[model samples]
Target: MRTAILVDGGFYRRRAQSRLGEKTAEERADELNKYCRRHLYHHGKQVANLYRIFYYDCLPMDKKVYHPLLQRQIDFSQSDLRTWMYAFIEQLKKKRKFAIRLGKLADEQAQFLLREDITRKLCRSALQVTDLKEQDFLLDVSQKGVDMKIGLDIASLAYKQQVDQIVLISGDSDFVPAAKLARREGIDFILDPLYNPIKPDLFEHIDGLRTCDPHFNPNWSEKESTE
Candidate 1:
């Protein structure tokens, strides 16, 4: 069997950071490659040949944006996030059988909003508007063409019969239609949410649910330790 692994980059990064802790760009890239390869095997046996790993993400916003809290123009182009993201992408490009698909940030829709916890506090009357600090806000931006590209790739892979199995590393229900299409094409659709809890409705759309997180999979951790 041939398997193609598709990753939602933003989702993966967030989950990885939360579960595995932060790492340098190079380390993160290596971890991502290792995680994806683990899906090629099951129960200590290789079940499928890797076709390619597809990573979809948007470039960080590079334009200057006025910060309402800081009362200054922030140049995102020089931000550490931009630097780290570029390095990460370059590292991924160097990995064998990796395809990087980049979407773009919606510049016009970019704005800052109160963080979730802060918003909740304000709503509950525990915090006042004057209590808001610069760190209490986060920049919100929309990613354009990411979901569309993922859907298109799924369709293309299914139509071309390029792989017998399609493993999506995402928790988003937005791919339900794409998953349904792949299944109709006789492809096994697997979902690896990295141990994240997904909606129960998502289970019916996938052929299998699995994750290769070392923290959760003892077999994986044992294999790694031996290696």
Candidate 2:
């Protein structure tokens, strides 16, 4: 059967970075293709034919960040770390059967709040800091329009009968409506939520559930759920 795979770029990147560690972008590109194809394998037996891979993400914003601890303004977009990301995306573009869809990063500023546990510890005198001269926080960046694009594409493929099955690599519940539409169109819908907990309500909409493997990131916190 012809299968089209769709991946949430942000989700994939965060999971891979946390789990796989730092591999050169060139190396990661190779692994991305391999990782997608592995899903076609069932318990060591490979089945189905690939149609294409759709990767959805927005570019990092060219925005400045306020570092409370450093007490300075930093241009995050120009960081060497961002250059590494740009190089990685370039490598992904060269892969055959891979389509990268770009979205926009929200321009509004976001603030990072300390984790509740950390805040509690500080209140209980269990947490201490050597430096009292500066505040501590981080800037959070978010994406916009990515979900709409994903849903539109899913609808397009199903309505056009481009593939027999659609495999989505996202944990977000926002795709439930799209999944329902695909099923109504007679397309098999599969989901790979990366072993992250998925709500049963969301789980019931898909035809199958699978992942390339478990998350290798050993740093998951206690509050993270498997649902």
lDDT of each: 0.92, 0.82
Q: Please provide, for model 2 over 105-219, each residue's C-alpha lDDT reduced to its tens digit, 9 standing for 90 to 100.
A: 7757654555566667778887775432333443466788899999999999999999999999988999999999999999999998777778987767999988776554354
**Model 1, residue 169: displacement in angstroms?**
0.4
Clashing pairs in 1: none
RMSD of 2: 4.8
Per-prediction tally of clashes: 0, 3
Best prediction by lDDT: 1
What tens-digit string does per-residue lDDT give for candidate 1 at 1-227? 99999999999998888777789999999999998999998888998999999999998988998888888988999999999999999999999999999999998888888899998999999999898899998898989999999999999999999999999999788999999999999999999988777899888999999987666432346567787
Best by TM-score: 1
Question: What TM-score does structure 1 among the candidates reach?
Answer: 0.92
TM-score of each: 0.92, 0.86
